[model samples]
Target chain A: MQIARHIAEQPTTIVESYRSAARTLETYAPGPIGRVLLIGSGSSFNAGTVALPSMRAAFAGEVSVVGPQDFLRRPDTVPVRGTLAVVVSQSGASATSLEVARRAAAMGCATLVLTANAESAAAALGLPLVLMPAGDETIGPKTKGYVASVAALQAIAARFGADIADPAELAPNLEAALAAAETRAKALAPALDKVDTILVAGDGADFGTALEGSLKIAEIAGIPTAAYTIEEALHGRLHGLSERSLVLAIAADEVGRTEASTVREALAPHGIAVETVAAGPTDALPTPWCTLASTFLFQYMAVELALRRGREPDLMRYPGLTRRLAIKVDDSQ
Target chain B: MQIARHIAEQPTTIVESYRSAARTLETYAPGPIGRVLLIGSGSSFNAGTVALPSMRAAFAGEVSVVGPQDFLRRPDTVPVRGTLAVVVSQSGASATSLEVARRAAAMGCATLVLTANAESAAAALGLPLVLMPAGDETIGPKTKGYVASVAALQAIAARFGADIADPAELAPNLEAALAAAETRAKALAPALDKVDTILVAGDGADFGTALEGSLKIAEIAGIPTAAYTIEEALHGRLHGLSERSLVLAIAADEVGRTEASTVREALAPHGIAVETVAAGPTDALPTPWCTLASTFLFQYMAVELALRRGREPDLMRYPGLTRRLAIKVDDSQ
Candidate 1:
């Protein structure tokens, strides 16, 4: 499948994306960026969540991530004074993202667009575009796009803090994790395919990885899945789980270890299946690198699960499922 | 049945909660708060979401809502200095919330607790507590507690900025909405009870209402339910929706009306059921009052659906589901 191939090629694309963003940052003068607002939809939004640590470290002021739809509509929610709004979209054709860029530009924000396609609709808006160049993939369910966007954002964050890790250095760890994930997914698919629901939970920093994983599985396999902070899951979402529930937890640090164990123990009585994907040692690499590895591992699981369901990993089975995304249809007409 | 009664009495509880908070605010000195951080798990976190608009209006800096576990573990994610952290738990027994309050107080941030039970573990923390007494609700699902927390937060935000809505004035409109919602729930339950999955979507301003609604339904009816921003739902979640799926949307304004309509049209071809619960005539009252109405309406829907399934509305069907929350047990032991 095209998306699987894209997933396999992300280690290289992510490195290239970082280098490209680094070069772009040399000349990009985003003056007095008091508050950093990252705006996107779908996977881009998920990427923003994972990139928060770097963003916070780079910026002195508050950092926030929000979907483009909200920023476009309720501009008041985000303060425009001394603010920089970074708009991210893989295709650059997402109607909501374009609207957000336009609105932010009009509001006198230091607006920037991060995209792979320079000729896409969003590029034509005349906003300063930082090209990440993730290459082209016809099939949806972004893999390389998500990685490239995060890598690019990390590069932008680096401009603010010299201590930010170089994205080029993350590829080796990601490749190793990918190889390990390939084996793990093949072995787990048969058991996972039989499950009625998927609950993916991640500790604080890795919550976005859980969200993106749940989304990939849902879109690729047509599975009923939900993601939450492990803390939120313990609150009430656990009632939805049972013997047919497959719980995938991401834990990269000590707190996550505790959370993952607690989840497993609590669900053990209900006979719910549990799996943990750890990002190895947290101190061994930059936080985002570990986060990317966890994210990549989940993407492989989604691909393998789609195959187990006798569905094409690249092509979505449900019609109109991806219809409402990236493109704006004039349904009102 | 007890939860339903607790829910019905919230209009009065909400008013009293706000008045109590207002009186407490006169003596509270949370000096020079630069940022507002509200942390909780489950319904408490959702209540923080419902209060975002007011929180934003009241603070000069940023306002963020996060689960307590995340805040406690990923201390770097949130800016601590000159921050006001409002810790919320209905029972105040949530171990995660207590840890968060303790950490915030140690960090020199002014910390406050909003809870229904003063004796429920968290009150002993010695951080000044603004009691929002929601009365006794032995049921697992929270109704009055949610209403009261929002009221208290609203009162706090009012103290910070004079422009926030007056909770005292919101009671009559809430009473009117409650009378209307009881009728809507009875008519909607038979159809909803037959659904295999429930997908609740709300526009930007009302997304928290959707979250609370989804939580109520999940705990009370034991339904497999998920909530998303209307735009996020359009992105990918629609794939899992079909004839047996029920979609509840909240649209209280022009933009939301458009979004709700687009969602209905997009899903109609797939035979997915869509229901829009709009808080009529926003000009008649403050926006948060209308939002509370929509939240109450969904709570009633959950109660009616629980009755339709022949499940006790007050008792959670799944044992040990809420056990892991609030109180942390030593899993290693």
Candidate 2:
């Protein structure tokens, strides 16, 4: 129920997040940036993926996104001249992220710390801090926080003159996505309990959505899920699928639809079922906007699947998972 | 039987590849390079991954590896001034790889085409060509081609002034890895039949080995497999693990051992087993060398497991998989 509320609140959250994102971008780098290195984990990382295409389009010099752990151990070539390291940690309490900010600054790179926790240590470190609008999303698996981060990243790219549409323009699409997604998710969640494996496939920016979708099913629905680009799904990875497998093919673009259809044919012999998520015919959003809105499809399915399995959607199967792993810095610290 | 013989021939293949790799580097650059971008698909991608760390160390400016599909649609920042696009397609017949070479060259970037097929369209384009010693690997899933590509990339980095050990130095280690891996693989082959899923974990350069390991199992053993860095394996993904899950942790360095131990302990509650591949005490090979040689572990297991599963180790479940997808240029072309 709490997650359902968060999902409903995403449209409003995106508006507020956009304002903060614009201000953050100006403060982080007054001039247009030629290079940017983004670092985040889990849902935060997924948000970065949504923005990468536009960000790459804007900054013709260079732009890349890596998870926090990988960024910590990345080559010295990073934080190179004129590079801005954008740290997107909703909690702003990841140990690796804190270390990355310190190292990036020490290496003379411009840095910005984006999070909902303004008092967090990473935010208090004199780094440029931008607070996300989805404040205190107590749920273990995020919905509002996910949309808020997506809004912020897209806004920053748009601010830098990328061909990204305003996040506010997509708010209505978000609301419509949730309503349509709920009916479909409720119907599909029960059958997923019998599946041994779930494969999510997409292309380009849609690949990012597929990954987030896979992560949600595994984290909340307690299913074994894997994400691959549409092309890669046709690669050798298909040999392992069987009658017990389920595939979610994202028809976000022509490329996605064509490849997903090919993949569907390839899996015909194995009795694997593919469910395609195509954009609504009447949707106001276009291209990536409609595609990105489809994240709601996975979010709704995760919640419905969790409750169907007699599990709580808001509470994680392993409470204090991040704390126990020492990935995020302890709030008490 | 075909894949097994190829696995046994890696040490010999690597030696010849190193010779060709050295000559290729001279023909491609002939000087220390500042930036390089490597691209491949599947196994070729994995080989580029193994060589990435040292190559990054060699090129102080920038060094990155990407899949050919991603590279084809990559940001204009790629193939930047002073960048070298290293195309690692063993067959050198992938349409995507050829397209990338043309784009990179047209953008004023130096290019190298590493392949086993001298007559392949990519090599016939008259770009800097380096012949791999894999000869004609008729088998569906490659073993010698993987090691040969690795040798070529590493040799290129070393030629560009990176502190990489000679591939010849690892020949003894490869022989030992194959000998030791065979016994362990044979034992593992039968027990894997009951498993529903497998997760391979590693860190740093070992992460490259994890990807290749995951691929070999999925491609040859007909098992669903996924690979992740040790830290990433712990990030929420652990929640999806069940008793039927098998984990292979690669302890290729101190960082790997420490994180792999942490990962092993994390999966204890789920009753999941974590099998580690650690370097032998007397291994003449050092950190990444010993670690790179660990690819033999997966290669051996894939062959043995295929046989145990009543499948042919030499042929893929779908022999004309790539051809049907139209990813590779037609051999008739």
Candidate 3:
């Protein structure tokens, strides 16, 4: 809650920090490197999801988000050949991420490392490093760290050429959105307390954000949750839907707003309560949406839900599970 | 074993029949479309893993493999403006796939249905139907169905400009491959009786085949098995490497042969025995490599593995579970 209050107050600071970081790219990254590769693990990966569309729009080329494991496995499949490889890691020393950066470097790629630790292995790859001040981590699961990564990515997007429509004008709006999130988080406390399963749905670019939000709930609340694209939810998965199931619909912009509304309407008729985190009213005719704002809201909601249920909002019991584990690939041998 | 023998003996007949059915694609699919959406559920989707590269290379445009659920909830994202929807289903009446076909038709896109049942909803859609004569199963967990689906896709590829480097010339080699697979299936009885898990790995075009092979083993033998690209295996998952983990590496063609060999050699150093099915001499190599005559060899390997385990090769305990699932979109309503 203290961290949430801090976020509510200094939201603009995070945004400003991100903008500054983005500007640095123009100076550090030289050449016609056709595309961008946003790499991260876990929460950092979630931030990359939000950054992708924005970066793609700004860069006017292909922008893909791949996990460190994916890069290590088949670097060739990645769309960006001889392009910028942006490596994001929370600890900076994430062994898998470090190896990926090394692999990229070995492949003659211009590696860019983004992390909280300036001297991490990922940074040691002799890449231009963008280091952020470490955020609060009451429990190791990552709340503030996630937000900080988002801030960094957002700043990078603004710097590159994002049509963000005036940062000075939008700063107060972002703060207000955070405030709105705080208010909504309190209202949703009861539902979060009882619900064991949550389904988050989004369309297009927001799909990845919904996935990250669902993952956050799973990691923080220790609950079973599945995130899907809005259309994917309409498929066989809806069979698992019941009044008991909490549905979180994330609608970022007009691009997917209609589909999200259709999903909300469909679920509501089935007596399923639908909660939305968007830029405008769920009932609005045409809503202006911000995916970043919506993602942050849901993330905050998940954290509050965990705290209200007496669960540690940041500590993850399932970290380093075999399926999620990352190992350094010593390519030298 | 009898089934394997039957398949081996009638390889040309089966291939020709499947290829003829695949020719129907030209009738339904006329010209270049904006996108090609391939829809399938579970193991059927694995076929897309193979179809993706080939389709993209031939079509030279957007080709995405989506679950039917994804199509239903967000029809707009289905690339309806200018798209060809290909739905792959074993039992033509799969509820989710049916919805996917219906939605694609509603979107005014050319719908191509590939299935074993010509009378199923997929066929009734009145689109281009590639019917596999594999027949319906009284005992069903998708043993023959999986083989039929893969064969159908391959046949379609071969028909639709799939760089088949001398079609008639490849026929004899394919027949021999099937026969070799039958011989290897008979020989594998000893290994099949002992091993609990079969880990399959491939790269590039063959990666999908490896994934489908692993799924077949899991479905039929009811064994815990996993599949990954040769590169993915070297990531963190190699920690599970042991002599007990029966490694089945499918090294096909020039692309993935070297990586597959590297994986085989790496496993050998760990004292883990590796069995490879390839087009070349796998003997001088570290693994016990069998020169397979056809891709069908892996299918027989799955069947033989199941038979040796004393499990009914085709048992679907989760009945209606398939219908309740959506490959592209959910149509439970």
Candidate 4:
């Protein structure tokens, strides 16, 4: 499948995607936006999380990420006026994303759509667009689309005011990670397959990587995965940990790496296996790019686990379940 | 243990807790506060989430909930001035909570502490305190503390501007839910016990209840639980659904109920057993109270699952894990 190839092309694609949309982002959400509301479902929302820190650093305003349902349920939670809703979706036709975009526009806030499909239903809404540079994606689980979304947002943040690290700086690390993934993923798959539950923990911006990675693992590898902000793993989830559980900790910086190690040591006595992936020393590359590499590694791990289990990575086990709930249509109403 | 009895007394305790803090809340976070930030960890964070809608309705500005680690790591993500940090902790000694309170104060935002202990380290930070009426809970899983935290925030929101449904009005419903929980939880235990993974889904304000309940189940019942917003449950989680998976759908209103039922119907084809807990009609009591009843039911369900598995509900399994992460001491440093 081209999924693995697409994942490997992330370092180059991110820079191209940013360069392609630099001018649009300058005006897409221009003017002192009091708050930036990133709304999406699944991988799209997780992608926003990966770019959240840079957005916060760029703008002297609050940046928040929530699933589309949250905004729909409580529009009052968001600033109706000075807020810009950055609606991200691989397929902009998703009913939830469209509804959120409409609602955001109706509230007099500007809407910006980032997706692989510019001709999608969301485009018909006449919102500003930042089309993914990777173009069309046919895979069931998104690989290129997710990274593109993050990279595009990083471009927007840079235009806004953030001094983001250059994507070109991440090329060597990305190539190294991708080159090493197949062997590492194959080796890790056996241990992961033996586990009943997987907990992926990360701190700071990289926490988004954990969430994105866990979702892919759950979707493709058929593993029951729970990804939390590293602290949350301790707050309540530790009770469910046992010898059968595997903890994959993704750390972007030194403090996060220390905390992840402490968590591993704490769970060691309970016979839980811990796998740590330290992405960077904080200054290696952009925080978002560090997370991209970690996420890419986990994506490969998911494929390897699925391959080991004799299951098709692209064809998820319960194929119909996700499709039925992806978008709701009410003919009766 | 008196945990069950304490959980049952939540109705009366909530009203008393609110009344006791009514004057303090009115003055503590007074005036046209531009935005409100609620910070906590685990159940404390969930409690803030339950109160988010009412707070949004009451305030003219944005209302947000973040774990303490989020605020501490990225204070730039939160507004410095014209914001109030409502910090909730069952025990006022949680190091993370204390650090967040200090950081928010340093940023010139007023700090309000809502906790059971008024003399603990968090209260010693000299912030305004709304002491929990439940008082002196020692259970590891924190059932009463969770409900009490939500009630305290609801009271604060009422004082802010929201015409929240009265806690007194919810007493009857709360009592009814508690009464029904024993039989219902015992019945539901067997089905849940057979599952390899449990997925809990809820929409709107009630989503917080789902999160808190899932945490408790993970803590006490030793289940790998993933609590997600209704849309998130449909996004990528469905790929892991099987005959061994159990879905607990919590609905706070008609729309939520319908959406949850759609989730159930979609997952049914995948052999996932779905349990829907329709909290109330939208206009029943108040959104917060309906969630309270639903949360109470799940608390009992956790207890029942624990008892059925010959585990201690009050003394959670792997007790040392939480304690180790609860405080970070720098002896080596």
Q: Which is the leading candidate under DockQ?
A: 4
List the pairs of residues colliding in candidate 4: none
Off by over 4 Å in 3: A1-10, A78-82, A134-138, A166-168, A253-271, A279-289, A318-333, B1-151, B154-333
lDDT: which is higher, 1 or 3? 1
- Off-target runs (Cα >4 Å) in candidate 1 are A77-81, A162-172, A280-286, A320-333, B74-82, B162-172, B280-285, B324-333
Q: Arrange candidates by DockQ, highest first: which order?
A: 4, 2, 1, 3
Worst 10 residues of 1 chain A by lDDT: A324-333
Tell me each candidate's i-RMS in Å: 2.1, 1.9, 9.2, 1.4
RMSD of 1: 3.2
Q: What lDDT tens digits, residue by residue, belong to model 1 across residues B142-188?
A: 79989898889888888888475675676677787787888888888
DockQ of each: 0.54, 0.54, 0.08, 0.70
Q: What C-alpha lDDT values do all the predictions have?
A: 0.79, 0.76, 0.60, 0.78
Please provide, for model 4 over B1-333, each residue's C-alpha lDDT reduced to its tens digit, 9 standing for 90 to 100.
567877877778877777777756666635568888989988888888888888887777777898888888778666666788889877777688888888888888877888887667776787778888777567777877787888889888888778877777677766776777666887888777677888888876777878888898888888888888888888887776668988888876678778778887887776778888867422345566767767876788888888888897877777766667646222100
Cα error, residue B26 of model 2, in Å, equals 3.4
Worst 10 residues of 3 chain B by lDDT: B284-293
lDDT, model 1, position A77: 64
Tens digits of lDDT, candidate 1, A115-205: 8777788778898888887988667577888889988998888888836677566667767767777778778888875677788888655
- Fnat of all models, as shown: 0.52, 0.42, 0.01, 0.76
* Candidate 4: CAPRI quality band: medium
Question: Worst 10-residue stretch by lDDT in candidate 2 chain A?
Answer: A279-288
Task: State every prediction's TM-score relative to the real structure.
Answer: 0.92, 0.94, 0.61, 0.94
Sliding window of 10 residues with minimal summed lDDT for model 2 chain B: B279-288
